[model samples]
Target: MPRTVPRLVSAIAALATVAVLAGCSTAPSRPLEGYAGEPKGVDAPASSAGGASWTAWLEDGTQFAIVLYGSSTCPPKVQNVAATADDTITATLAPAPGGICTHDIVPHTTVFSTPERITKTAEVKVVMPDTTLTLPTRQG
Candidate 1:
């Protein structure tokens, strides 16, 4: 009986380890669109309004990041973007996948490649849920 007990415990341990690994990879994360680095030139105006939504330039002026603060583990990200006008963009979020999320406020940045039709010379407006973030005019 003692020998069988040890073997059963070992088997349970192995199963638990496999379950953890599978759980980590099962849920989808926000796919990376481009480099998330901060741009050196003219960029978006930063604000903590509502302490949640914000925007920043990335990869010079070719890309930008829409940031939302919430659970660090399951942070919400911009799933889709389309230019509604020359200086305006419409943003949407993906359906929140079910998973354990850390109870902490951290920035989840979703990078996006700037569309060709979007004007870079004027104030760019990103229309998001409950807010509209504005980016300053791009400078040389």
Candidate 2:
């Protein structure tokens, strides 16, 4: 009987310790406003052609940075930008010379300002050579 009492008390103490530690664990933080996902769909054909490969957030809510990375013999330029009714902004880019591009990866970055501020759940669409990526903005 004496041995059983000590064992039971030790078991209760261990459980209490675990409960306290679990309660002290931190919760996950919310994402910052205007935060977007990393660049995607930058593979194969797009990598062979110059295009807007990825996008990132800027300090200002209405501005974003677009990265053009690929292997176009000539530099690429932004041709058109359109905003759809579904809160998605699309930007199209093509090579300047319109010929066979090199196989080397060239990178360029440019900043674009939107007519209005992008809210938490807005989407950004990047139209590349053979693909389009739609990314959602961070919610916080």
Candidate 3:
């Protein structure tokens, strides 16, 4: 009985130590939030080339960035700063893929402003190609 007491105590202590280590090593997870932006509207023109636009408004205390996914050919660009307020900045569309081309805008990073104020409206433009062609074209 005396030997059994020491063994039981050691077993409990080992389990407690394992529990403490497991709790210490576990990581905490947080929910992902969307970017701070208000959509003004989207614009697309005909003729398979030329004018296209995308606009958005940013809110206060939010940081954001612009990302463009495009083919190896023509790429998108962030145009002018359309509007700027005390706590906001607006950007206009530049040019990007059009004529059956697609692109994705991803927010890669964010920068915080002082006093937690809004900053930047976003804009993007689509530019069409003269003609469509497949990639990795084989030469005859």
Task: Flag clash pairs in model 3.
Answer: 60-118, 87-118, 89-120, 89-121, 90-121, 96-127
**Candidate number achieving the greatest lDDT relative to the actual structure:** 1
Instruction: Put down candidate 1 lDDT per residue, 1-140, tens digits, no spaces.
Output: 99999999999999999987664322222435622323235343445534557776666678877777777667676788877667887887877879898787765667778767766899899898788988778888
Candidate 2 per-residue lDDT, tens place, 104-137, comes to 6665555556534235366666455556755457
Q: Residue 98 in model 1: shift from native, Å?
A: 1.4
Stronger candidate by lDDT (1 vs 3): 1
Q: TM-score of the candidate numbered 1?
A: 0.65
Pairs clashing within candidate 1: none
Question: What is the overall TM-score of model 2 with all chains considered together?
Answer: 0.47
Candidate that scores best on TM-score: 1
lDDT of 2 at 102: 81
Listed in order, each prediction's TM-score against the native is: 0.65, 0.47, 0.24
Cα RMSDs, all models: 15.9, 15.9, 18.5
Query: Residue by residue across 6-61, what tens digits does model 3's lDDT show?
Result: 99999999999988766432231121222322222322223213322222222332
